[model samples]
Target: MQQSEVTESNDQAALDAEALQQEIAAAGAEEREAVFRAAVRAQAADVLDHTTIDDDSNFLEQGITSLKALELTRNLMSLTDVEIPLVAIIEHPTPRDLAAYINEAYAAERG
Candidate 1:
């Protein structure tokens, strides 16, 4: 193959690798979000009904007190091996938002 063709092939390979890495990262993020949601739901179970813990539901409105939020943060930190801030659940205020925050923080910590 010509030098130009070789360079093009290498470039394509690099691009493919980057895409695959992105896909893997995205999958990992989704998994993390799912786990976060489940953990939050479990923690909230003592206060809220099982069905009230949907992704978009307001945790505070569902009867999650500040103490429960702190418990959740600790539980999540233990489960995920990530150092979650005590106010994270309060700051995020919803399962989806909290999951996203946790994912971002976890990624930053990993990097």
Candidate 2:
């Protein structure tokens, strides 16, 4: 992608992130968890071009490089409006774990 394309994507992610934050704020607890999990799963799938993903699937094992991990982190950070380090995803290593980590981090950040 070109520099302009990257900037455009970032701009759109910011706008989408703001809207996601609002939607998340309005959701109930269970709904919020579901939202995060589903978002993580979807983002992972889209990033890796995998059609189906299990919550417990290991991203690294599925061939995720640092670049791919960074992309995933960027998208999740945009969706959740939280700064998730790429290392966190490596440590978490699964969609369920990553989603929980992001949710917890987001909660702490929000509080």
Candidate 3:
């Protein structure tokens, strides 16, 4: 192949890589938010029947129990397709924080 043709191919390959990275990032973000929201809702439901809370709501302060925590983790595992550490759930008790943690884990696992 000609040198110029090889350089053009390399350039095309770089652009393709950049595009793939952007697409992966976008999909990861969307999946992360979706998983987090689903987990939060599941946690809330486990704690309170027919109740709704904001994304930033504090589950612990609102009486979220250990059993409910496990339930939420289970729900998140189903949604995220990633193995969530029990420690992470315990460390990040609030819904928003836990969601962010879950997002990171999901993205890392994908990477």
Pick the TM-score winner.
Answer: 2
Off by over 4 Å in 1: 1-27, 46-52
lDDT of candidate 1 at residue 105, scale 0 to 100:
81
What does candidate 1's lDDT look like per residue over 1-111, in tens digits? 999999998887566546543543566767866766665666566445455577788877877777777777775665556688887877888888887887788788889
**Which of 2 and 3 is the better model by TM-score?**
2
- Where does candidate 3 clash, by residue pair? none
Query: How close is each model in CA RMSD to the real structure?
Result: 15.3, 2.6, 14.7
Compose the digit string of candidate 3's lDDT tens values, residues 1-111: 999999998887566546544443566586646656655666566555536766767767767678776766765565455678767666876777777777787677877
Q: Which tens-of-lDDT digit does each residue in 61-103 have in candidate 2? A: 8778899999999888878888899899889999999878877
Q: Please, what is the TM-score per model?
A: 0.65, 0.81, 0.62
Residue 2, candidate 2: alpha-carbon lDDT: 100
Off by over 4 Å in 3: 1-31
Tell me model 1's lDDT, rounded to 2 decimals.
0.70
Best by lDDT: 2
Cα-based lDDT for every prediction: 0.70, 0.86, 0.66
Q: Count the backbone clashes (under 3 Å) in each candidate.
A: 0, 0, 0
